[model samples]
Target chain A: MNFKMSVVVRTVADIMIIPIIVFGIYLILHGHLTPGGGFQGGAVIASATALLIVAWGTLKDNKDDFSTMESTGLTMFFLLALLGIIMGFSLFYNSLAGTGGIFGGTVSGINPGYINTGGTVPLMNIVVGLEVVAALSLILYMMAKRSDALEVEE
Target chain B: MLYYILQVLVLIGLVSTAVAVIWFKDLISAAIALGASSLILALQFYLLRAPDVAIAEAAVGAALTTAILIFAIKSTDRTEGYK
Candidate 1:
């Protein structure tokens, strides 16, 4: 990769990725009431990560690390979802709201319109986000590694 | 309202991109086009008020799927010329 071109493309791509990640975060945080949530925001964030990888190449070469991250993230996500079930709520159910808080909030509590009160939803979001990021990073790393091995062979 | 229009446009875009992916010769370019199609579908999901599904689709469908496809293509023999 030419230094100047790499720098410029990397910088440009990085600049573009930041806002998308921020927007993804916003969606995740405000998911209770809006049209965005953990999965969508997480995916958006993952795309940003993908963009980074495309722009900057693989950040590391330890395939085992990526695999570990993927497994851990997946386990955490499942466990969080399980928490809702163990609490007597349906799987992936949003059951962490009471009945009253901030006016017009999006919380799942007693308050009808609050956005910040979902008990397990936010936690679920975090878990899913982590899983998504880890899964994506691992996949990309593996792909790059495979390509590198092929290049060596050829 | 405007939302419906946006949703329709997104759906159209998604379908068109899917077609483009199918028609494109280069595997990598096709995979990228497929990602774009998935992103458009995600947008449609948002429009349809299912953000969670949308997000999952975008991540798994667009990002993960495309990467896996690219990897698979890279490892396989490149078939000369398109059918």
Candidate 2:
């Protein structure tokens, strides 16, 4: 049925969710020069979603938003990948590197690290992070809803 | 010397947890054991000089999989078979 966790668990979940989300974003944003990437970051964010679902029972159905996000991420990823082709490069090419644009900074030899580098990689990481966050959250939400929906006898 | 010892201990923990996952009769206990196994595996991955795989495994394997299993278990039976 509509099962909500105890107050202690709920409070902890509330407190912990913020850091988890921030770390996930950081993972996605600095994926180029870091150990984490889109998928890992997305999964981390979805874990926060999972924590929410477990702490507080599934109430509002935000499936539509998540669906739109997943679709948008995928479409954007493809568009970004194909943009390199229009720019006279192969699919998934790093055309923006050394261009001094958004994510177009350059890295030479073995420097420390720079955030504004890695061309299309960071862009893909963001899009993939979006898709994964939506996808995994959607999955957790659906399962939580389904579990709630199931008929249980006393 | 210490590094090798730590790696060996982690591997041992990983193997024991894997066995515990199968040995537990209660579904919740089994799920928790599986989570422990995943965590130890993640640690092993970290020790092996692969932090990326370690982070992914720790996040996905230890957390999400255990939550899903518990949720699925709550809907039906909490034990093995019809005992």
Candidate 3:
């Protein structure tokens, strides 16, 4: 059962997919300094996934992988939040802020944004982005697969 | 002045798209119209200084939701006005 769109759509999708994914990553990484955060960036990446799915119309889905990644992302997120408590701060505290660690620094004034200035915010953004991307992509893949099955049966 | 004009235009587009979504009898057409509405809404969000929301809305509402609805229509009837 071959399921694929015509050549034009597939070509366009192939061309656009990488840029879309890159933009999503940009949103996630700069979330603390920028307008977009984890959820928005993840949605953007998942939209890329949707584009690929729609254009190809079929996929060899590794459902286990997506679910595993989703779980890992959520666990890592909570672990980070819990680590703050272990580090003598409250849960969800900015443990890394002003500590000269990765994603650690304090912005003094209104200026051009630095990527590593948000402490735990960037980390949280990344984890949430990962979870969202994995979950939404999995949903789209499952739905596409199910619809394909229904068509075959009909 | 330009910002206000753009906002007004987007709002008009948004309302018309919303109407089109309800007016279309073909499920796929309606789905596409919904996507258009979502896109316009995203534009409005950006105009309102909320790029985060605009990105989310464009991705989820315009793209993924449209894809999901289209696939759903594939598994069911394409048109909606029939008995």
Q: Pick the candidate with the highest lDDT.
A: 2
> What tens digits encode model 2's per-residue C-alpha lDDT throughout A81-119?
998999998998878888998988888989899998988
Q: In model 1, how many backbone clashes occur?
A: 17
- Expressed as tens digits, the lDDT of each residue in A1-154 for candidate 1 is 1112378888998799879889888877777666667667767777776677666765556567757766776788788677668889777764555523432224334554455566666666666666666666666666755654665553
Each candidate's fnat, listed in order, reads: 0.60, 0.63, 0.79
1 versus 2: better DockQ goes to: 2
- Model 3 residue A75 CA deviation (Å) reads 0.9
- Across B30-62, the per-residue lDDT of candidate 2 in tens digits comes to 999999999999999999999888889998999
Tell me how candidate 2 scores on lDDT: 0.90
* Alpha-carbon local distance difference test for all models: 0.70, 0.90, 0.89
Q: How far out, in Å, is residue A53 in model 1? A: 1.6
Which rank order by lDDT, best down to worst? 2, 3, 1
For residues A1-154, write the lDDT of model 3, one tens digit per residue: 1388899999999999999999999999989888889999999999888888878877676799999999999999999999789999899988888888798877888879988798788999999999999999998888888875764443
Give candidate 1 regions above 4 Å deviation. Answer: A1-5, A62-69, A81-95, A99-115, A151-154, B1-16, B39-64, B71-83
Task: Specify the CAPRI tier of model 3.
Answer: medium
Q: Lowest-lDDT window of 10 residues in candidate 2 chain A? A: A145-154
Instruction: List ranges where model 2 is wrong by over 4 Å.
Output: A152-154
lDDT of 3 by residue, B10-47 (tens): 99999999999988989899999999999999999999
RMSD of each: 4.9, 2.4, 2.3
- Candidate 3's displacement at residue A62, Å, is 1.3
Candidate ranking under TM-score, highest first, comes to 2, 3, 1
Error of 3 at B66 (Å): 0.6
Task: Point to the candidate with the largest TM-score.
Answer: 2
